[model samples]
Target chain A: MKNQWIHIFSGTVKVKLTGKGIERFLNQLTKNGVSIWNVRKHGSEAVTFYVNLQDVKKLRIPARDSNCKIRFLERAGGPFFLSKLWTNSGFFIGACLFLGLIMLLSNMVWGIEIRGANPATEHHIRKELDKMGISVGKMQFSIDNVESVQRELTDKIGALTWIGVELKGTTYHFQVVEKSEPKKAEVIGPRHLIAKRKAAIVKIFVEKGEPVVKVNDYVLPGQLLVSGLYGNEDDMKTVAASGEILGETWYSTKVELPLKSTFQVFNGSEKRKYSLKIAGRTLPVWGFGDPDFKEYETEVNDHPIKFFKWELPLMVEKKTLREREEVTRIYSREEAVESAKELARKDIKNHLPENAIIKGEKILHQSIENDKVKLTTHFTIIEDIAVGQPISQGD
Target chain B: MAKKWGQYVRKWMTQKMDLPQDVMMDLPRITMIGQVHIYIENHRGLLAFSDGEVRLMIKHGQLLVKGKAFVIKTILPEEILLEGKIDQVIYIND
Candidate 1:
């Protein structure tokens, strides 16, 4: 009974009766099991009373010798407020508002979210959705064709193998599977470590295999550092190789340091902006302008809404604008030369083995380049630099 | 002529002969006793009351009332007996 949709129909009734005559009529109607009330006269000769269809059919005249007329108005549909057929304007607007509220409440989504992927992949997928104009605080995403979204995403990011999307209640969920990358096979064949650059052999360690060069030997780029083949001529064994042959390569480097320099440094002040997307067009809710940091740097961060495409959930990109300051200093020629040599030594030291000991160092040349002094250095080292241990399997 | 025909129809409908009563002897009675209002409904002795207090006796049960002056208006089978100025009513189980 509660689930049934009951339609109410109402119609006005006109009756001819005096004040006392109407009272007697209502009393008789009540006595006959016809439940009604609010009976009142609209004019001098007429009285109106509301009655249900069943009771209307059962109505009967009370007096036999009296002169009274009963006329039934046209049947009207809707509630009492809506059944008034006289006026052009009434409570229709309020009724429409009430019905609209019901529809809006039932259609709204309670939750919206992305699912079925790791944070990284999910972030990428969410970004793509933002590009396609999905987002929060907007109308619920009621896309009928989710396959198209999935297809667009897979086409954009090759790492995603498959994807799925669904709507439950008011929430939208995304399911994604990432494609796995294959591993490279190990190199079991014989291979040798050759010189990657033109440098003097400052240190050498020949373990397992024979060394082609000794310490202090000058070597060029592409020269073999570790020999895969061993023994003198006939006794050479064609064996699968293992073990490290550490070789210290030398580098002649020239470095320059200016007496005056200008560098940009960030002061770390930022302003935030918000944006929204609708129908594949992005609209900025906040104004676009330079950050209000005069001495500080500026950065722009943009974050895409997780469940909504056009809605920005957070700021992701930070474009930092750093202000540069000029600094000046004066140095003697000897100081500048020493500083240049120190810089060159430091750069050359990176390519040598950790245990290599610098035996001697000398400045090969010094010159002026641009606004800075350039000094070239030569370094000598002696150390055991072996990379691999001997691997032997008994037959 | 139309008014005369309507009068004849109304008289015929109202003058229908009453049928013999096929009343059910057993009827469920609900009596509500509260701090303020006391309601009593009896099926055999069709009676109901709501006021300050009411004392009633029906079948084997006895009810005691206490409060201001009370009134017992009408009593009929399938009809209600109303009491005014009733505060409370206590019923003793037989």
Candidate 2:
């Protein structure tokens, strides 16, 4: 009873002995360091007792010396229990496989819901998602995170003004905002079209107005180009002046172009490393060691894991390191001057309206300073110069 | 006569040194809890055991216990625990 707990863990055996000198047999067992407890006598020559499972071997010599017949009644305890479990190993493996299948199913993308989008846009978005491997039944780990999905969708679709992506449980939800055209407000009051800038008239077509200025006539700002009053002064009627006036404008710009330029570009050699982020810490999973490239661009993408409807805190992060190299371009003197004039022309074009056309370009002055070509250039452009002015009572 | 004198001397020493009699006289220590259990220590060996009686060899004599449904709860080199309904306890000199 003193070490009964230890005996249960190591195992215990009940043994029965039948002999002439049973007491001598018990004493011999004690002398051999085999502890026995709960001794009960069946008759004058038969006795039963519990002994440590390990001491069953030591009992043979004692039983032989005492000329007794020994029999093991039962064995019980931890070893027997483990052996019983081993006999049913197939059932244990089946339970484990079932649990793994449930986990895999829970992490799959089961459904996709797109809201606030038309049927056409929804179909287009679903196609894009399929191409990106985010369709139904796809494993969530193999797809990009929600933020990247939102960015990619917005970039690919021209009609979407804004889109929101949310991952809930095994489904992906998309909230879309389509880009709609704004309504225009027209000005129909009696007005006059005046020159908003100083320019020579190139072409003019008056509609519902009287022509006040002719082609090739130079006019100043606020000068009338089209008048809303028509007919004789006795029967004059007022109406809105609406017409297109093409004007030729001049622009002078100063630009400097470097003779030599150096920039970095990707060399197409990339290394990918995958790691797991747990509790805000990164643990490298696949790739080991730092990349050897000195100049490289790093791009990290995180895909959070999900367990049923709950988002797990752990994430799989993929880091891509792309090697880049510096490139240098040297321009000749003539080439630099030409590029400077082109740069000035592009600058003026950006400032003008969409319908403006560049008529001519000329380099008025050119100089070289510190390996850069500087020039002053004049550009000729044709654009609309008329702006509506509401008729005042005094006018 | 010599054994009797030895016992007398040991008893006088026990009284003078305030020593327990069981230790000084080399006698088995027997403890009983009502009539259900008995614990014996400082015994030489188990002489015999049965459901009705238990016998142990002490230093100078054989200690016997008569009980109904007797069970040897524990047995070691120097100790024995007995569980049953005790009827009598006696000692037999060789």
Candidate 3:
């Protein structure tokens, strides 16, 4: 291998020779395509000159008998080092790498997020977005008519009120606002508050109109509870189109709670896992397989695909396993009775609205029915089951 | 034979005396008095002295002077002065 030459000193090259001899060397070097850099004299006896490496190679001297000495001094090459770094090949390769990185990053959408949507509205929006070529793995070039596509999607889907598309860095973010459904106006032209499901009426209160069905009446779905009629014994005139109905409905419920139940309580020590999904395929990024917890049950619900407006994209799923301890204790006769009463009250409460008033509760019977304790409860409640609004003249 | 003897005598005298040829060559010299300090590059020796005592060595360019509380008022790159009672002085060869 040829020796790699580097200049490590900066002072002038000194030659203890006559000025005529120095000029001769310069002429010879120039004839051979050598370059001279600088020349300086320290005193009368020595003259130093700097030359390029090519010129240095072409330098020759006469016989040693002549009164002249030739010595090669090192030169510092700090600026040369900087110049070499800016070479054509190095600069070209650097530019290519940078441009390649930018191109690759622009092709992949780093962020895709949807906001202001309920689950159902978001699902429809996601489907619409996918049809508009905004889904994962779809190139940006495929989307030709962006504005018209957005307009068509919003007009067809009743949920989306406004949609916006934004590109930040390499990611495309879709922001959406769902249109709220208009509420139904009250039926003012001869209507009644009807039952929505099959239930026996337990109590009734007439707040604004006459009741059609009395208490203890078994009503089916769509059966009217309050009549929208007025006038004495003669011809019944429909004064108001609809009347408000407030009645308590009853339901029979059978819930089996084992005498010795096993319930797991988490012991605070849990393991968390993370995954990344793309196009229905999930890739685990953090934890390995599903975790195994001691004395614990695992419930895994993995949803690898997510929709934004109408576009389906990849989603990350997280699962956690926690250690648990199951403990069981025996219940005395009074404890069991109280437990049964509580369970019956919960069952009756589930049948009524959140604002229902429980007027009274009476235990009809308590017995062991086929290896399970059963308690029959008779509850008097006042609740409003009227969902339709009464329409007036102006409305 | 006499010329050879004279050359040997000249070399012995130079070695014994140790006189430097270039007095203004790169020599490190520092001077300080009170709050000001000065450094003279390529210093040779003291040509003259006034207002304070001067101690210098032409060979080693080392000089130190002690006095009764002198303050360095101002400083430049080449020259320095001291203002106090001259108590001690020393010099060494380069």
Highest-TM-score candidate: 2
Tell me the TM-score of candidate 1's A chain.
Answer: 0.40
Off by over 4 Å in 1: A1-187, A190-204, A210-236, A241-249, A269-298, A306-342, A349-360, A367-370, A381-395, B1-94
lDDT (10s digit) by residue, model 2, range A1-395: 38567778888888988888999888877777788998999978899999988888999887777778999998888797678789987899999998678778888999999999989999999999999999999988788889999999999998899999998888899999987735577758999999998899999988879889999999899999999888897987888998999999888888989999999999998898999999899999988887888899998988777666666788889999999899998999988887887789788877999999989888899999999998998888898999998887576
lDDT of 2 by residue, B40-73 (tens): 9889988889999888999998999998998888
Q: Which scores greater on lDDT, model 1 or model 2?
A: 2
TM-score of 2: 0.72
Q: Which lDDT values do the candidates have, in the order given?
A: 0.53, 0.89, 0.55
Kindly indicate the candidate among 2 and 3 with the higher lDDT.
2
For A81-108, candidate 3 gives per-residue lDDT tens digits of: 4455566667779889986665544555
Q: What does candidate 1 score on TM?
A: 0.35
Report the Cα lDDT for residue A134, model 2. 94
Query: What is the lDDT for B11 in model 3?
Result: 66
| Candidate 3: residue A107 lDDT (0-100) | 53
Q: What TM-score would candidate 3 get against the native? A: 0.35
> Mind giving the per-residue lDDT tens digits that candidate 1 earns over A65-98?
3345455553434544453533535566667787
List the RMSD of every prediction in angstroms. 22.5, 5.4, 24.8
